[model samples]
Target chain A: MTETRISRRFAECAAAGRPALVTFVTAGDPDLETSFEILKALPKAGADVVELGMPFSDPMADGPAIQAAGQRALHGGQTLAKTLDMVRRFREIDAATPIVLMGYYNPIYVFGSERFVVAAKAAGVDGLIIVDLPPEADDELCLPALAAGLNFIRLATPTTDDARLPAVLANTSGFVYYVSITGITGSATPNATRVAEAVGRIKRHTALPVAVGFGVRDAATAAAIGRDADGVVVGSALVAAIAASLDADGRATAKTVPAVAALVGDLASGVRTARVGAR
Target chain B: MNTTPNSLRNGPDDRGFFGIYGGRFVAETLMPLILELEQAYEDARNDPSFKAELANLSTHYAGRPSALYYAERLTEWCREKTGGKFGAEIWFKREELNHTGSHKINNCLGQILLARRMGKTRIIAETGAGQHGVASATVSARFGLPCMVYMGAVDVERQKPNVFRMKLLGAEVTPVTSGAGTLKDAMNEALRDWVTNVENTYYLIGTAAGPHPYPAMVRDFQSVIGTETKEQFFAAKGRLPDAIVACIGGGSNAIGLFHPFLDDPSVAICGVEAGGHGIDVENGHAASMTGGRPGVLHGNRTYLLQDGDGQILEGHSISAGLDYPGVGPEHSWLRDTGRVTYVPATDKEALDAFQICSRLEGIIPALEPSHALAQVLKMAPTMDKSKSIVMCLSGRGDKDVFSVAGHLGETM
Candidate 1:
């Protein structure tokens, strides 16, 4: 059987004795050019998968951190098309890295879901993490992405019990995005062992890989979870880092990229250490 | 019940547009937030846990299953009104019993929860009749969230009870001065609030108009009405009603009543618009359905009550609720599709219903819904005696009594 591109990408990362490092960046944050630079810098700094957040006003699950980043991005003239153009540009330099466009579905649906998926695939997005789209609501996004050969990454939180796991797993095309806690993005404390238990539980359902996110702030937390999980997603923390640059001074500054990239590198190293059994 | 459970949404690439009506028409600044709202709404709407939460709030907090009442007295009232020939049976699915005493609570509760889910702490909304504002403020109080209600200065004076109600509900009432000081102006003010406070605030639109997902999504949230009514009627009479009638302000409540009845070809759906006075457009009626042409008013391009040059015309109604310059995009779609019929009731007729309901049924109805009741009085009498009609009493008449007193020359 021909393994899907996401499965192939996961296999490559797994075979390298390293966990995949997924970084989340609000598109056009601070400025579009600066955001492009930040995206360009991630792969070199050891991010295997990059998640570009489409800035939106009402991000339901986002904490104060991501919310502020979204404000900045929106203020910076980031749009659905602009974010896609950003990806289309980033793909030119970084083709090997799996780019996961993770955000809300409204923009994509607004852009015409079929056109969005085809364009996203053409621009080099491997998967989609539409935070809450599942089987019942899958027709608008998930099914279309599956047909377009883009992985619809499903999120499984603590709320996802035995009754829900099978359906969630079924809706997923790429590696499952397991939300570690029940709360919003920045509210949870990192529970890697619990995440590992979740990953173990999920493994029984499918051969598909699992990534643990939400409150995986620092390297220690990331490694603890990445030690057992296939991929690690750092979103609100990076957003918090970016938000620090805004400060009392309204204009966004450069500390945004380094603050997040340095943490990403550190976490990437931790995951590598765990893979080599150095931990 | 071979329940395939067809969701109310159209297919993807469908744009949620029933036809050429619903589309996202917003400023560049609001583009992201609107999209986010669309996405979050889709997700939470689909998520079982989220649905359970909304359902819990609906059943427990919103006091759902707000009695499908058989108006036995009103049925005989129709019998006498129609010369005792073709008498009719009327059942009102009383949405007025919901929290805040209006069907607007249903939409406000759902949207407020969506805002909360998205970590939005502040809610801003525009109100004309103040039913939606009162509903929004109530939900804001219930959720412990800060809320802002924008009302046209004209509406401010007319709907004083509602303005006072909003203030008591812990919401800041911003009186809008622009554009005839009415619903459009209030909407402009609310949009300004959204643009300024886009980060922490969620603009809870009062009606089933505006951008793509909103018109459809709001209808979806409010669709629990038709869904409940269909079931309740089935339990009561073992069948669907011959007609579903509701008044249209921005057409939210009417859409709620009409959406479930869309697939039922046999069930006639009628929407009553406020015909303020006079016979035509120059008379200052808020009959968006009748006086409106295909034009943009609020967000989505739809049938708008406009002047000769395509400028949206000012609207007037005794009921501040019905005094709107435009209808929801989906309502325009429904109008064109002929799936649902849009009718007009003058302010005098609405007031007449207000008096009749209070006199006959001992139920004083909100002015917004009085139009529907008035229309029911007009049309139900013309229908077969055995034919059942369901009127969506969107709210109680408590808010309108004082306002109506001034009109009827009663000093109390």
Candidate 2:
């Protein structure tokens, strides 16, 4: 596979002796124009990699924050076709930062898998993190995404034991998303000690960079994760920030972009300061 | 009793798709847990002791082989309504006679036993009409596990008696207020709970729906209805019925009755879906087969009541149990394969059947299965008198009496 922007960015972060800061935002949250502004501002605000959420009506794995964000996005008339359009527009100015499309598989399945993968690739998507497709069902999406020259990232949870590590890491690329907590997103704080160990355990099986997410809310938590991992992923926290910055009518206030960018800026600083062992 | 080879039951294939339906369309966090569940169900199915235990519970606790009683009066009424032109023999595979007053106990009993075997101490279920909730509560009480049932708030008001029954059975009933406050929302909430408590919780899906092993596993458990009906029908009449019918709401009881009869080519099968007011009117019915397209929801691909953009639309039905937007994936496959005929029954037609059955046969059927009786009321009188029809009286109507009274504009 070609060295994509995701791999290059991780390598650059490794050379700088810091973990890459990964940020997540739901596409078309509040409105498409405001969401695009948030997306364009994220890179300068210090997000090394970006994951744009494709909103679906039912997000089974999400907590209230992300679920509500998706509802807002869908209510604002966001569709998969439009989400790809956002990526195309974002690529016009910034071409180096890797963009990952993350969400459930139903929307893609509805759009037709081959058609979605082709459209996503043409729209300048760097990778994918389809939450529902397991290794056991790799033929469904993971292998096809990988075949389309896009990185198919897989997640390893606390419940994923040593016996299941090989299967989890078998076809994974770009990175291994280590879900730090056992529960849903933003539900609780993860144990840094346990996360460090889980990252180490996953590294033993694959050469891919490991990014810890799901409960890494603030800078301190990101720094704690950065101390050992190759990437620090902050999703629900950023989504919650977007939600908090909304006005009474749930529309984007003047502070929406700035609030999200400020949070990303602080998290980037936290990731940069923390020292990690060299790969 | 001429049984052909079982060539039709081999579906869902290996990846859980019943001919382009029923895949694990959930989030990745639930993937490991879903895999673990698939494995556990496989082990349980292969274990003879597990089978023995489920069989014991079905017979001793749930009152298995619920009698197949010939509804002579209902048959006569059909003849009278048809101006004595014709009348098909009618029989009820009396699932309402089972403990807890519904066929839902068959699946709950099987699942709770599996839960015990898997060492899960907490049981979570989503109920529409509250029969599944009551059944889940009963099983949880019997198994000594803490239980939480997600129910739509609209249903909570409509089926208060079953709600009280669940609470009395020591299960907490959580009212879900999202997405039309019906079965679909309740299922969404239950899935959220399962994702939150994946370690110690076992989600007891009531119907033969959801992702892979669930559609297959729940059907295997509920297949007792068809297996017993087959043996009992032969014993009583020395022949299989010419036709079999059951109501479809996520299609548990219907699949249960239809599965064992799939190989019997001579035995025609029909599944009746609720047509709320009417399928012709906008947003009027829960008749997925008639008015819906194939889509994914609550983990499986099935015919769903959805808008043009694939957004799942809330299904309308007087019967809370039949108010879900999607049918079972297996039923979708069956409808495509021409193995089973799926039809719809409107609210007025079902209500009429409800009263007709109550007054004529002295049997008050649940609103869900009353849809089947409504179709039968139209179809049975047209068939020759030599023909026989067996319908699954899936539940008793005690929980539905108040809803029926309100619909009839009659005060208690």
Candidate DockQ scores, in order: 0.02, 0.47
**Which of the CAPRI classes, incorrect, acceptable, medium or high, describes model 1?**
incorrect
> Count of backbone clashes for each model?
4, 1
Interface RMSD of each: 12.7, 2.0
Q: Quote each prediction's TM-score.
A: 0.60, 0.96
Q: Write the per-residue lDDT of candidate 2 for residues B253-372, one digit (tens) a residue.
A: 999999998988999999999999999877789999889988777888789887755566787999999998899999999999999999999999999999999999899999999999
lDDT of 2 by residue, A1-279 (tens): 468899999999999899999999999997999999999999999999999999877676788889889889989999889999999999999999999999887778778788888899999998999777778668878877888888999989988888888988889999999988777777888899999999999899998999999989999889888999999999899989999999899999999999999999999999977784433
The residue-level lDDT of candidate 2 at B29 comes to 61
lDDT per residue, candidate 1, B156-251, as tens digits?
998888999999999999997655788887886676567556678898998998766788778888989989999999999998899889999888
lDDT of each: 0.79, 0.90
The best candidate by DockQ is: 2
